[model samples]
Target: MKYRFVIILLSILILSSCEFSQKRYKPDWDKWKNYKWILNKNVRNNINSGFTLYKKNANFNLIRYNENNQLVIWEFKHHNYVSIDSINFFENIDLSNFILYPGQTFNKEDILETSVRINSDLDIDLHLNLNSDSKIYEYINKDKVKGIIGKVSQMSLSDETGYHQVLFDFPIRSYNVATLFFKRDDSFFILILFPDDGLVKDKLKDLNLPELNE
Candidate 1:
């Protein structure tokens, strides 16, 4: 009886520790506002998705252009890195070698490399998933060899600078997507590009952006 009681207490303690650790690593969104934003001209022109990327150390601030040509800003803080090689078809090729062509037909393998990283650890992914269908799973099936296929209507690329940026139009009806591939770091940073619809556009009205005079 004493041993059972002791075991229960130990289990509770372990659970508590895990909970605390998760909370500790949870991103502090409030503090993210304080990071300085430096304009990245290379990203602005090369991948002309109407969004400009600003660097803040390992983090980035994205200024997205809505359908109306208005700008909305979003900040992305890197939480953790997931290797692209872990995904099936991507295992043999480096992500940088892949070029995205707009209006091109791509199978599950093409989107998998980017979608997995987006879905794996970000709250933004959850928000998108709730609003749209499970497009990610739509591509996966019994034959790991044969995957789902879809078309990419909007896409952009930039390789001039050291960092490679590729923007893939999200399968979701209303969202845009941009991903940064860093050669030196061997990692990718995903940025959610909120569509310039009335719902999201109104909320970003108060965001202070850098001067466009330059």
Candidate 2:
């Protein structure tokens, strides 16, 4: 009977150790610092989908719900290369040019109808503008380009609710220049569009975001 009790206690210790190790392996964002919240009328009007931008080191990150209604995040790094130029470039561009047909898969030709380029050397210009390292230039240059169709979906976060026009993919270079427009009541906003580069996959796992309802 004593040997049976000892075996059960050993099993309990093994399970507890496994659980502790799993928890320890998880990434913790709360420990990270230097993230600052910033407001940009342009971002508010165009790309953020009415959400605020978070600047971390030199990278800019935004979080929002995608067409699938899943929480997705977009990140733009190496900002010193593109920030001002991107802002000025997008200011003159009209978003009305790009509209997605519902229930259809969009292509590069469909995107061209809206005046946004799938790939532009102008993006490469950001790297040149900053006189970035060759490796950095190559990284941006080699990033694959893809299109994200713009569509509006109603979403609520905390107490605020609005209809957000989801658009484009990121690294900012891929979409050339795109925008996300949001309307909440009588107010309208725009943000400079970038491609959805999926840089937030691991970060999202770290955040432990709750499963959202459709």
Candidate 3:
């Protein structure tokens, strides 16, 4: 018996991949947690004719709004594969790095990629690592950090001009980070920060994290 048909074809390919992942995703425990979206209308007229972020002092809220293949199928059901989902920042975030909230960080992996080249057509660190639930931090750089290579910008509002942000600070080094990217009608809107330790850089130079409101 030639290895008995390779052990019955690897046990029918692991039971047909667990019966096609329990029939094309089944664990919709109300999509776990943190969700509430409704933009449609070309993503609410492209964030309502774009460019209007002057909030300056925190209250950042994007609350896990997915749509990059439904956050890659909700990271295949994240928030609790073994527990981890506590970002809590949408109710007067009094200060810190100002505002760069979204989520995803591992504390460090020695990333230093900054040549600035992300004007659209999504890649966003491969969909922000399929929306990580690792939850290392998200207040903009500092402590046991080694992650700051992210760069992307193309928050276009149709032939844009004026408001364009792609924040970063590389002055003699203090390990701080901030990144933002937005796009609609094709899905993509990202905000990330978690490499801080630069002591809120003079209140993030008087902040401006507000965006999206129509």
Candidate 4:
């Protein structure tokens, strides 16, 4: 009987340690890879679908369910030697339930507001959001270039295509974008981008609209 008690205690300790070492953020990258493509038929059903040219300095392509929906932007560089990064934003949503890292939490609503404010304050010409099936998608394109700004003379940088484009640059901004969202049963999935890339940002944005802000 004493030996049985010792074995049970050892088992409990092993399980506890294993649980502690496990990763809290479960990742699912493939969920949205295929979803990123926009079928030509999607554009036909949504007439708001089209790419916009902004003063030859930037390009934006989008599809919308309505005019008031929040915009989603995806931008990147196309140079052979240069690579771009992506960011994803949400409007009027409670994103705290979604885990990004161990003991990390963020509000989806705040992210959207910040992006809106930054682009608007910079006079970067914020695009319109189109809503459908409850989701809104927006795509943005910019000159592949880099610059500097802010009070400390903070260095600003971007690719020739105007996107930060790397995953490493985002930790400072407090984002660990996991584009894979589990399906209804946590089996299949959906891809969500904090900052989307131009290659598929527009394509994904052209997908079915998500539910609206309540």
Top candidate (TM-score): 1
For model 4, residues 85-160, the per-residue Cα lDDT tens digits are: 2323223332222222223122233432211111211112111111111233332222321111111101112223
- What shift in Å separates residue 89 of candidate 1 from its native position after superposition? 9.1
Off by over 4 Å in 2: 1-28, 31-36, 39-60, 64-79, 86-122, 126-214
lDDT of each: 0.30, 0.26, 0.25, 0.27
Structural similarity to truth (TM-score) of each candidate:
0.29, 0.19, 0.21, 0.23
CA error at residue 50 for candidate 3, angstroms = 16
Q: Over the stretch 19-102, how does candidate 2's per-residue lDDT look in tens digits?
A: 544322122343222221222232222222322223232112333333211222333333233322222111122233333332
Instruction: List the candidates ranked by lDDT, beginning with the highest.
Output: 1, 4, 2, 3
By descending TM-score, how would the candidates be arranged? 1, 4, 3, 2
Clashes of each: 0, 14, 8, 24
Encode model 1's per-residue lDDT on 39-134: one tens digit a residue: 243333322233232333233333333222222233334533433222221111133343432212212342212211211232211111111221
Model 2 has an lDDT value of 0.26
Best by lDDT: 1
Q: Model 1: residues >4 Å from true position, as ranges?
A: 2-7, 10-16, 19-24, 27-30, 33-173, 179-188, 197-214
Output the better candidate (3/4) by TM-score. 4
The predicted structure with the larger TM-score, 2 or 3, is: 3
Task: Give each prediction's root-mean-square deviation over alpha carbons.
Answer: 15.1, 19.7, 17.7, 18.9
